[model samples]
Structures are given as C-alpha cells and as structure tokens.
Target: MASRKKNPSKARRYSVKEKEEILRYVDSVNSKQGRGGQTAAVKKYGISALTISTWLRGGGASSFKIGKTSSNGAGGVIAKLAAVHAEIQAKEKELASLRSQFEKLKSSI
Candidate 1:
C-alpha cells in the first residue's frame, strides 16, 4: 500500500479595492441583465458565485475598515461592530434556513 501526502492550498486573498472593483462589475451586469448576473460574474471573474453573493450582502470589502486609525478610535470600533452585526445577521438567517429544513425532514420521517 502506498500512502499519498495531501497538498493544502491557501485561499486567495483579494484586497479591498479589488473586491470593490469585482462587486461594481457584478452590479453593473446584474442591473442590465435583471437576473443570473452572479452566474455571469462567476464565469467572467473566475470566482465562485458564493463569494460574489457574500460581497453583495455587505460582507467582503464592505466590512473592511477605511483609512488608517487606532483600533480604539470611535470610527474603527464602530466599523468593526457594524461588520460583526452584519455577520451575525447573515449567520442567523442561515441557521433559520437549516432549522426549517430539519423540521421538514423530521415531519416526513
């Protein structure tokens, strides 16, 4: 028996500006096409539709703190707080959907 070693690949990180550019392009296409624009963005940008969706939903670049400031500064803290709140909301929505699915499955069984 031969043992194979697994190669781990790191996720590519996009700078705030790059993320904004990708999002702007996605928005433009979505506005013109009216639907399935994310699919188009995924194809054009070589990024997953889920990543595009995260950007659209106030995550990604939108969560980044703008300008240089101390961590304890009001602006920095507020921005961080807002980002956390948005993430919490997104997670809550996902949890609700999973719970609904679980309920459906339980009822069927």
Candidate 2:
C-alpha cells in the first residue's frame, strides 16, 4: 500500500493578545452551553478540533477539558469576526440606500 503524505503547511504565530481573544471566544461559547458547548469553538470559528486542542493546551490553563489549541486561534477568530462585521455593515448601508431609493420612487409617483 502506498503511504499518503501529509501536506506541508507553515504554522502561523500569534501574539499574546491574539491568543487571549481566541480563548475568550471559546470561553464565552463554552459558558453558554454549560458542559455541552465544546463544539461551538470549532464550529463558529471554522477551526479544526485538533487545532483547537493545541491552542487550549498552549493557551494557559483552561477550566474546560479540551484537546489543545494554538495561540493563533484567537487571532484567527478576531480576524474572521472583523471581516464578517465589515461585510454586515456594508450590506446594511446598501440596504439603507435601496430603501431610500424606494421611498423616493414612491413619493415621485
């Protein structure tokens, strides 16, 4: 049998602040679900279970028992959140403009 090779990917480095953010998010989600919210971290963040495990292991002591997570997990979540927020804001502005246009059309008729 031919052995499958793992793809080579460079590990991303994260700062202390960034790591805290990821753990914070994880903590927040875990809190809401009580002991059943472990999957929230991975699902919401699109993070892999293995990656999250690594992060938790390296990111100080966690009250919840998880595998591990990298310090960069927080940064990743923050970055994703920022992007989503920007997209939502942009859509809101566009919606406002469309509503205004509709109002103008109605008023003109």
Candidate 3:
C-alpha cells in the first residue's frame, strides 16, 4: 500500500513553531475526544497523520526550541478566535461603508 507521503520531493517542511503548534492542537483534541486527536489535527492543519505520529514519537524533537503553551488547549482556540475577531471587524467596517453609500444615494435621489 502506498502511503500518502509517496513523493519525498513534494513533502513540505514544517518549522519548529509549526510542529509545536500542531502538537499542541493534537494534545488539545486528544484531551477532549480521548483519542483521534491526530486525525482531527490532520483535517484541521492539512497535514498527514504520519508526520504527526513521528513528531509524537520524538522523531523531530532534537531541533525543537520548545516553548510554553496553554494547558487548556487555548493555543489553537485562541488563534482561531483572533482570526474570527479580525474577520468580524472587517465585516463591520464594510457594513458601515455600505450604509454610508446608501445614505448618499438616498439624499441624491
């Protein structure tokens, strides 16, 4: 059976920070689901499960400049929250612009 990582040349390199983030996400998922955290991370991060397994086994730990992460799985959640907040801000600004345009058109009519 051919694995998903069939082409070595096409394999993407993950940075130390990325690896740690993925590991944290996996930890978060596993803590909540009791298992299948790697799979959840694969779907969320678009990474292969084999890569996550290797990292979990310390295959990529030697070069890792490990940093502190939240124990409550807030690392992943907080990043996502920040992204959503930014999007909401942008949408609000757009809505205000559209409302201003509508008022201008009404006054001109």
Which one is best on lDDT? Answer: 3
lDDT of 1 by residue, 1-109 (tens): 9999887876878766677788777767778988777788789889988878876765434444454532334676687777779999999999999999999999999
Question: Please, what is the whole-model Cα lDDT of each candidate in the order they appear?
Answer: 0.73, 0.63, 0.74
- Give one digit per residue, the lDDT tens place, for model 2 in 1-109: 9999887986766555665566777777777766433477667766576766676765443422222332246654465566679999999999999999999999999
Per-residue error for 17 in candidate 2, Å, reads 2.1
* Per-residue error (Å), model 1, residue 84: 17
The residue-by-residue lDDT of candidate 3 on 1-109, one tens digit each, is 8767566567698767788788888888788989888899899999888889987876333324424432224564465567679999999999999999999999999
Worst 10 residues of 2 by lDDT: 63-72
Model 1 poorest 10 in a row by lDDT: 64-73
- For candidate 2, the TM-score is 0.39
Cα RMSD, each candidate: 17.0, 13.7, 14.9
lDDT-sorted candidate list, best first: 3, 1, 2
TM-score of each: 0.51, 0.39, 0.47
For candidate 1, give the lDDT: 0.73
For all candidates, the clash counts are 0, 12, 0
